[model samples]
Target: MKPPLDLDQLQTFITIADTGSFTRAAEEVHRTQSAVSMQMRRLEERIGKPLFEKEGRSNRLTEEGERLLSYARRLLYLNRETLAAFDDQRLEGTIRIGTPDDYADRFLPEIMARFSRSNPRVELTVVCEPTPGLVDQIKRGQLDIALVTHNDARGQSEVVRREPLLWVGSVNHATHEQEVLPMAFGRPTCVWRRAACDVLDGMNREYRILFTSFSATVITAAVLSGLAISVLPECALRPGMRVLGEADGFGPLPDCRIGLMRGQTDQPEIVDALARHIAESLDNISVPALDDATGLGFGAQALGRGRRGTATILPGW
Candidate 1:
């Protein structure tokens, strides 16, 4: 029989995959670069397949590596759960988690449900704010973990989910047909707002911001009321919204990236558990599909091109 895979080696492999560099993974895992390389070599030998291949200046996971990653994450997660189950003392504490209001409605329910079931004794304090506010809270160590819309200029974060950013308008309103396109958007600092304005400027399209708010509810209200159009990620889509694409004269925007930020905390174990649950929940989220009756051929095509090819769009505002 083939020998069992080493848990430590699997962990190192996952670290490399996450960090996208042996050097960075070495620092994260507290091992020398050469030692990290040796572990990967043995891991590859055990699997009898090359897990990674050189791509330009970086390493890209091979097909086999991609196949192993899912198994690796599951194995490590189960290992952690098994160890935690036997501990004499049950985990108990309050963990403060922050997320932008845009993601709160869609993401929090699943995450809260899963984490609470596993760690019933743990108390959760959820703070809903914009990404910038969440980042500030993390910096102040007021939060244990934060889910933010990843923006490189803002700071570094571990990105967990990515989806196409789309232009959306009310299905009942001909908002996009307006000569000077009325719009709803987030505050000036929002990355989606910046991307939308930049794209519109590049296209020489005239537009005016009719409404502005950090709350998704406000933006969705504007769109649903047929007051304006807006930009949004796939996961935030709501009913009565129709996606506007190149056919509608709006240019494509960059993909939206969701990231996690960790703050200084005394309860590392609880934080880690919550972080893992957050990542897993985000991964399992399926985007809702657009209604075919909306006659948004372009938007429907765009949705089909996403990672899961299933979901609607809500304005990022």
Candidate 2:
């Protein structure tokens, strides 16, 4: 019989794969980076296959790595389910979560503020990253839950909020209907890039990648500086930023979903309560009524509908 795999190693491998950095994985798992590396090496040896290809600071899972993903997920899920089934203690433990800097900047603080107030006993850790990183982190059990930009359907997550991605630029930028449009984008792996590129490809629109970075702030800065125009969630647009009238050749991008995800669906009370609270708050948020009198650009529409304190975001803007 094959020697049973160690749960610790499985979890370490998953975390490293999900975070894409040994340093980040070690912090998530509360282990040293060297220790995490050692565990992964042992895991690869035991399985007799290389799980990940190390290139620079980033790591991509090999085919063997992908094959082991489901097993790791199942193992982690079963372990959490079993623990939650038998434990009868009051809800207490740190639940680390990942969120995008854009969402964290504009939306999450208010919701998390409320969550902290209600559950004084539960510790919540929020890691800010781009959407793809957030999704991978959740899948690997690095994050208990995440608020992220929705992309391709991920079997491991549940959508709690869905919102449109909008096109924005500086007011001074020129519009071009005939030439390749310039764009400022997040990293290559970002959902926004995929969404933007897919639409551009479908419409056969010519375009050029003007600028790209992992930092939302950098992208926003580039757009704000008139370096290049960009498409982003409407909520991210700010004063001095201009909303380019929708890309003329493309249909609306799908609403991006953001919500809770864990290796195990069965969650402890604290985690479940936090998820419910976030979902309910998201649903209940009310946008302030728009001013019919003002004929502002597409950017202003978002703020007009956003109530200072309300829930249930409507489509449009």
Task: Say which candidate scores most in TM-score.
Answer: 1
Per-residue lDDT tens digits for candidate 2, residues 1-317, read 89899999999987887689889999999999899999999999999999999788799889899779757856765575466556566466778867766666666766686566555557888898766677777777787777765555644467666555656666655543437878877777766677877887887888899887776667767776777767765445455566554544544665545656654434566667677666645654444443333212354454333212322111111
Of the candidates shown, which would achieve the greatest lDDT relative to the real structure? Answer: 1
The true-structure Cα RMSD of candidate 2 reads 15.8
Q: Can you give the lDDT of residue 42 in candidate 1?
A: 99
Q: For candidate 1, what is the TM-score?
A: 0.79
Query: lDDT score of model 1?
Result: 0.82
Local distance difference test scores for all models: 0.82, 0.65
Clashes (N, CA, C under 3 Å) per candidate? 6, 13
lDDT of 1 by residue, 1-317 (tens): 88899999999999998878998999999999999999999999999999998878677799999789878977887786676667667689999999876577777887897787677889999998888888899999999999999999777788888887888888888999999999899999889999999999999999999998877678889988999989887666666878888888988899888899999999999998899988877766654545666645445555644433234333442
Give candidate 2 regions above 4 Å deviation: 1-90, 175-178, 246-251, 265-267, 288-317
User: Looking at candidate 2, what is the lDDT of residue 101?
Assistant: 69
